[model samples]
Target: MAMPPNSVVPTTEHTTTTTTTSSKPMEVPVKPHHDARSPSFLRLGLYPITLKFEDVVYKVKIEGKGTCCGGEVSMKEKTILNGVTGKVSPGELLAMLGPSGSGKTTLLTALGGRLKGKLSGKITYNSRPFCGSMKRRTGFVTQDDVLYAHLTVTETLLFTAMLRLPNSISQDEKVEHVEQVIAELGLTRCKNSMIGGPLFRGISGGEKKRVSIGQEMLINPSLLLLDEPTSGLDSTTAQRILTTIKRLASGGRTVVTTIHQPSSRLYHMFDKLVLLSEGSPIYYGPASTALEYFSSVGYGTSITVNPADLLLDLANGIAPDVMQEHEQGETTEKDQKLVRQKLHTAYETNISTRLKADLCGLDVSNHINQAKEVATRNHVSSEQWCTSWCHQFHVLLLRGVRERRFEPFNRLRIFQVISVAILGGLLWWHTPTSHIEDRVAMIFFFSVFWGFYPLYNAVFTFPQERRMLIKERSSGMYRLSSYFLARTIGDLPLELALPTAFTFILYWMGGLKADPATFVLSLLVVLYNVLVAQSLGLAIGAILMDVKQATTLASVTTLVFLIAGGYYVKQIPPFIVWLKYLSYSYYCYKLLLGVQYNENDLYECSKGVHCHVVDFPAVKSVGLTNLTVDLLIMAMMLVGYRLVAYMALQKVQ
Candidate 1:
């Protein structure tokens, strides 16, 4: 049906319209909803979906505030969203307005199908249960911008487009989509700017928010859900972000956002308003008619004020100036309770009854579900990723490298490694033929430093990225296996680059051996040790998703390994000697020694005297031997630790 000029579009399903000329909202005539034609409100290539829910009651278990008797733990159920019920239609912007602790964020999460607790409700998309297919079609931009701070704006959107866009679309088309989104969000100027974090500065707060929205828009989603996208921004930026959202809604998208204390102008942009008070609905209807409805119920704004401000005051159970006539100043607890009760009762009697009626008549989704077309349109959410496994790996590989490439090779790190390498070379430079202990000390330092350095560097990887991982994984952007493999493999070149450079300079300067094969073998052991140590760090980080704890464990583990590697003490206590086998550091030390010296090689005993050092107690204790076992052990560790890490990541939930 064509709408008249200067008319406000219907706010929600079968609701009334308020035109500029009318002071009161005009009721929309009810049409026979039983017709088989789908009621999706837009045609954005994909059919627009009407998101509906009824009687949504979400509760969570919380620890009791009271002291537990007999040292027993106490638990209680807290209602996060108490019987929250509302629906959003395609091409309509529904802003969930409420004060703090009113369950706005909780309600938004539930709507996005990301809520993870006990929820009792009838939430259906196109009258179908939430599934994998809907997750793909739905674009959920979290309240906090969850983006890679290191990636430029264009790169961030491009990576998302590659992973989220269907494989049937050509690469060129995906790039075009990214550009279009950037342009649409007014981000073309800052396309190349980084989405910086605490460590760096890049885009403005508003631009960052826009990038978050653009990430979702790239996919051309039918439904867009945002949680406080205007949060922590100045009024001007907030208004701009809301304006972008309104335009997106106008272009046939279902938009639902939780807003806190929006200005009157911003409040007017919302097509519908769901005012919540302590998890219960106080009002639900067209935004323009909210004050009208409240006025009929004996509590309404007396003076000209932002509708959002009035709604928030009502949500907090503090009546607007209208209540000031009864009592001066602040409302007491009793007064608040009374106000809340009255408003909730009014909503139940006047608004909820009508909403339920409209929902019944507008449940075209359920009606459509029985048709064969439903199955053709919807699928289980298990078929999660839009791209194939190889394609996901490729896209993730690019993204991971783009994010982490500079981390290991930044100027400070480069200077640190080079300085250490040069100092080690000069300190042990061309050790005299008799200084066996000095050469041995340098080799031991190599093992300790490589083992310790790389372990700490990699230990914080998983913990730092935990939030980003959870956000992306929850959306089913890519499989955990692909992400794990991509992150690990992408870091390989960067991880080994400095180690190779350090070893190259240190090896020639130390002048332990002149043979080409010996030098190569020694370098190989150092690089291999670097990799094994990094694997240990990855395992620890993944298993214990806390950075401080992981760092502490890595420190203790490395110290223990260094002590047990047979260099610190010539003799070991038999009982605790098993720790040596558990330490990759011990294996690596033994291998480096094996590369430089063997049983037959002799060092000067003293003053032109020569003896087989391998036969002596000190050299024998170091356990220099033919190359097989130590190398094999470290190699096994390189694989085994990463396997454990992968398994640990699988249980993150």
Candidate 2:
């Protein structure tokens, strides 16, 4: 059977809101619940089951000391939110309401299975806690918009959609779906607009919020959780968002969010409003009853007051109305205490049960079972590994290539190549009068210098792209490997383009008196060096994750590799000699000399005399062979770096 939209299963069962009165309100008795037994990992390591949390209590310790008490720094960690409980059923919008610092965002992250704290309660999804299959099935949108600033709005969504959407859908279908979401979020005007800094701008704050919502929606999660969806927005915009949320919930999607100071007009839209103060539940129920519940306990409705403000007032402390009533003998202080006890008791009995009943709505177990069954039935064999990898890599590779074509620096490579040609031609006219060793030094120096620009570009490029990737990766759109591989492969041609052009210009102009095969071999070695440098850039970018740091590290490392590469110094210290072996410069220099110069040429150089005669130092075949070996070694290093990056990215969560 086809699943319902947002996965809500229809039922005739209904729940009614509860009410209580206080003129010295009667307190309900409290009862302890039986703890859920932990499951055995051995017998059901991969068995699929839904995650459930019943009677969940989360506490955050706040630090402070009373002014009257000791003025010492007290290790008192007050609870920010306590006895908080809710259920995220498929196809529902469950909004969690609280004022600022009420631990709403904390609860949102915890529900996403990503919070760092001690949780005293049972949280089971797919029969697993946080690390099981439920994580894959859920989509979390944080308070901050972690988008790639440089990518266009459409490009951002499309790239993520391509990775998250199953291959069962056609390209056209996928595009249509993404477009629909964009339109739904009202980002059509900025659809093709870039997602970056001042140079790249698009979409309004409200539209961006919707797009963020869309990003998670792309995964088609059964339950959607948003933190402060209307934050930093105008009252009008906030209402529109609330309207959309209401519609989303009405349309069978479960939407839960923590909103701060929602407008009175917007307050009526919430299906459920959970009130929190000093880390305790003050009220939890429908919006209509919120005012009633407070008024029944002597709060009574206030004229022209924001409902959120009223809730905060009572949660923090009662006002002078209570003291005035007490002095008038209308209500005693004992009665006030009795009212608070009754309200707390009602919340524990009525509100907690309603949330528990709603917990049954989520079907995390079913989804996990579906994923496992799909995996087993498909039986993706070892032979399909190559095909699977290619499929995964292609999605990112195509995006990277497209991004490059439109990149501002696209024409810079051509400019670099032309500049190299012009400069090398100028040097050709004054051709060095030194020995063959002098010419060898000139060729090596220029090649190393030529490699610098691309390395610098690679290093800086990833830092900018990482902001975009982090947002995409967090949304569960694609594997990190796809991003790293696609970027490396997509930019490979651009990386090699300038260096290859430089090699041709300098080789012919410098007139190295070498055969065509030797010229080609030398060119290959230099190009491989450029590739290795690019990989080095990627590794540094991944480690630092900062633009300034990565750029600095790349520049310094490039210089070290060039100097210690064995081109300048004839001999290095025994302790530092290993640096030569570690440097790509050493390989490129040794292999180039072996390819271009003969053994006799080296001997003549040692004799301290310039030699220009043809075959003066007969060239050997050994040097030509070393070119292939050196290039292979450089290729291995590049691959090894990429593998390390891939491993590191997988552990980012």
Candidate 3:
């Protein structure tokens, strides 16, 4: 047999010239624009590609009351794809051809290893069991375009490319890959353009469809699956996409997709067509033989109609109401019955048995069973030590920065800081004689109020990002750590800006005591406030994962903490006294009080001396010790809350 394309290419003269010449770097030759599905250039040291699925069956049960009548309705277990068994060899395209409800998409999910619900199936790629790591080898393009609304196509591709490909790959190489994928899918013309908003002005529907496919191809997945790739498209566009798909299969990558209705213009693109009806297989073979099998059983359907439409009509069967309501000389039950019988006999006797025999011969069944046993017995690595943990922190930081850079709402926090500082300074200006007691209270109040800014920002912004992040992560787009790390890095600059600016202005303007050390200490406390608040917001966001829920929880928690935070109301009832210990704000308050009053206890104000003044209980303790403790608690809160949120987020997913 000729060697499969999955095997490595030999180092021939052409290969050596391409691989070694730096002066003219080997560029993966771009295929002609019209040849949409050309194979990528063969590379050295690539892994083998293999696929296996065992008795895959996806079921959906409906048991809900009717919306209008409120009558109990129970749709018994409906098998979308019954006993679906097929092996996709490397470099093949399995086209699922069926009616609207034939469970085409459902079967695609099972085979793609993404569906959840009584999935009694085994899916393996390259002899490795399909799991989280295994998913890295597979890519799925859903029907909808999942592009970020605002980012340009290149930027969107770059963002995903950064986290997925290793740093060793030069930026030029990455861009080359993205461009290659674009060219491969015939997206070169709009490569640098903006992925349009809901209006979709920039690119055509066919271009958007190709972009969706390109996002998955960027990963160089061995198995690519799509749902309704040609849906809601013109026949010309549909045929164009299918042609690309056929080319991908020819390149030695297994491609599977469900298409609703394919015109004869696109029918030849399919390598194998699996027809389904009411959760059962009615036909599974070459597309050319489909009409022949039907006609032999007395259906005698003409090829004048679109093959996709004709097959669907035969499989779906005619409705009783339609047959009864029809006028004379319309489609009748006898005609439909004959067509159905033809399809049924063809599948029952020939196709199903052939498929079963094919499946039995390529039995990786034992390997799959053994892998499942090992997976069940294996202990989960410390959940605390998640893969790319530090990477997540980096992603989170970057994410924060991106939010400020991208979303206009974050600028409001800067406004709040400026407004608060100016307002506090004006209040101080009104009281020129800075009584030590009043100044102490002023500093404490400023520190306490500033914490709320980050809290509000995190609570509001995190929920939105959470949706996008979860969707991306679930699809295996990027590592969770990279996401977390980006958010953390991105937000740091913004997080530091408001507090740093406000604290510097207010520390000098509101003068009770002024020294280099004291100013620095006060600034530190203010920064801590930001971190603490942000951490709380993250924790709440992870716990709730809903905007309304996060908002409500953050509001209530802040209110409860403010009341119990030892500012205005302190002496709690015996029953609620323990809340003080659990409340994060309580610890923060203790640290602030320590910073404010530590100097007051040691210094006595006199007319002749530059001594610290002790005028009120608020000024009793103000020292480096209190400030240090306060800073420590805030750091703890920031890290502690984030860790807690991470744990809660896992459960949420």
Error of 2 at 308 (Å): 2.3
lDDT of 3 by residue, 289-327 (tens): 777776665544543767766677667664333433343
Pick by TM-score: which candidate is best? 1
TM for candidate 1 is 0.87
lDDT of 3: 0.63
lDDT of 2 by residue, 430-526 (tens): 3543455456556566557655666677776566766566656655455566667777788878677777787777777777655789888877778
Top candidate on lDDT is: 1
User: 1-653, model 1: which lDDT tens digit per residue?
Assistant: 11221122223223222312111111212232221122221111444677897989999998876655677667999988888777877678998989898999988888889888799989988777988878877888888898887777878888887888777677765666565566667776667667778776778899999998888877667679999999999999999999888877876667899998898879989899999999999988889899998888877665888878778888888877646643566557888889999999988999888988888888464334432343354322246666899999998998887776445346677799999999988888888757888888888888888998989988988888898888888777898999999988887886799889998998889877888999899888999999999999999999999999999999899889988877887678899878888988788888888888877888888788898867656457767764687778888999999999999998775
> Which is the winner by TM-score between candidate 2 and candidate 3?
3
Provide the overall lDDT of each model, using Cα atoms, as 2-decimal numbers: 0.79, 0.62, 0.63
* RMSD of candidates 1 onward, in order: 9.2, 13.4, 8.1
| CA error at residue 439 for candidate 1, angstroms | 1.6
Name the 10 consecutive residues with the lowest summed lDDT in model 1: 21-30
